[model samples]
Target: MSSAHALMLQGAARSARLLEETQAQWRASGDDLLLFAYGSLIWRPDFEVEQALPARVQGYHRVLRMRSRVNRGSPEAPGLVLALVSGGSCRGLVYRVARHDAEAVLTALWAREMPTGVYDPKWLVCDTPHGPVRALGFTLSRRSANWCGALSDSELLHIFQHARGRYGTTLDYLLRTVDGLRAHGIRDRELERQARLAAAHGLCTPTI
Candidate 1:
């Protein structure tokens, strides 16, 4: 494996710690364990969930700003992924897991989302049709090494055209996210704009 890939595998301890702390917090609340899903998780949750609800979280919005060096790209040609950054509000889904199965479910979730420790998993207040719930969300800080900041249109186009990892190309990932959000009745104009731009540049078929 590449040194970068090896380093990514080194986050197991951190993932375990975060999972432990989150479980403790959930236990203290004495409620069903809630997890907020955005991007790929919205469409392809690999874990079992007792319930899923459309939810929105304030004080954070989704952005295609995190650098993906493994799943969607590589060390030599990193790709972009969605992350919840500060400000505005985000519409997504909240998944509830029974307390009896929370530990196994969260452990698998951390393995999927926390490898390399790029996201900060936190409990955020999510507003749903039923009511408000505190759900664990994976957020990215601007100060993180994986933050991509604001990239120019040309730069994004290049990544979309060239970056690919074990999972697939960057453009495919973007298209999937757009479709996933649309399926859930959530429209992110910025994501739609990106899809349009990619199509115009012949990176992939038009999705918007």
Candidate 2:
């Protein structure tokens, strides 16, 4: 592993501590906790949720702008993942965890998402089919060390083609995320375009 990877992994303990602090704050509220899912969380929340409903978050759009150096790639060849960057709106899911299980659910969630502390977890308003609900969302900072911002089609294709990490290849992560969105009746045109381009270039197999 590269020194960059080692440096990123060093934040794991810090991330866990921050998550615990956040959990404590939530516990003090005595209310059901809601989590917003826009990417992998939609398909692989891994937490026991009481309800999952179609929801929308405004002022932020889903884009493949976050760099993954562990779960989906390496230091030399990082992979891309979706992040809620400022602008537009995103259609996704809002998961509600029971007040009783919130602590355990949050613990597991942090273990999965806060490995490198690249995302800023914040409370955002979600427009659900039922009604508007405030939910905890993991938002990306353009200033964050892990932010990849925008990349050209060729760059994305190269990473998707060659990058792999402990979980799987970058292509696998993208395909699964797109599939997950489709399963929820949401279609992301940008992601679709990239996936098609990658397949045409024989970089990655088309799964959409």
Candidate 3:
């Protein structure tokens, strides 16, 4: 594997260790879980409860960072995919769930996000109203027809623009992300720029 990939694996390993250590806390919390969202989840929260205000964390960036050919709309129809961009910050939303209810919440989230198998679930640290919360989030699916390390702003914007999902319009996605990010006191230069563009141009993503 490439050094970057190896490093990611190592990071993921360390993250696993952290989770292993935190398992009890996770279980004791009535099955509470945190979710880190960058795309549609920024808006829908996948029918999960809005437990707290959104927040941000360093070390992970958002992009068209993955592939999807199975669950989402077909490429012939908007053809949206995920990108694996790094080295920048991402500003998005976060969700909190009671431990006992996590499975139901995440299952629904994964179903909606992985409709075309473009992403994988992961645990991410989130800045929460009460400090930090560990969230279960998803990255692009490893199994996909069109997934990549990078995508054009326009390309990603297209997915964002054509934001129709099981929930609401892509515009709702952009608006909620922008608003949530601002609410969290988190600011990503690129995301902010995009949000501005979305506002000026009437939302970068549109409902499918």
| Candidate topping TM-score | 1
lDDT of 2 at 82: 80
How many backbone clashes can be found in candidate 2?
0
Flag regions of model 1 displaced more than 4 Å: 1-12
For candidate 3, report its TM-score. Answer: 0.57
lDDT at 61 for candidate 2? 91
Question: Largest lDDT belongs to which candidate?
Answer: 1
Q: Total clashing residue pairs per candidate?
A: 0, 0, 33
- Give the total clashing residue pairs for model 3: 33
Candidate 2 per-residue C-alpha lDDT over 1-208 given as tens digits, one digit per residue, 9 for 90 to 100: 9886676667776687779777877877788999999999988888788999999999999988888887888878888778898889999999999998888888788767777887888888999879898889999888988887778887987898888977788888788888899998999999888878878888767776
> How should the candidates be ordered by lDDT, best one leading?
1, 2, 3
Off by over 4 Å in 2: 1-6, 205-208
Q: lDDT scores for all predictions?
A: 0.88, 0.85, 0.53
Q: Which pairs of residues collide in model 2?
A: none
Q: TM-score for each prediction?
A: 0.92, 0.91, 0.57
Residue 179 lDDT (model 1) = 97
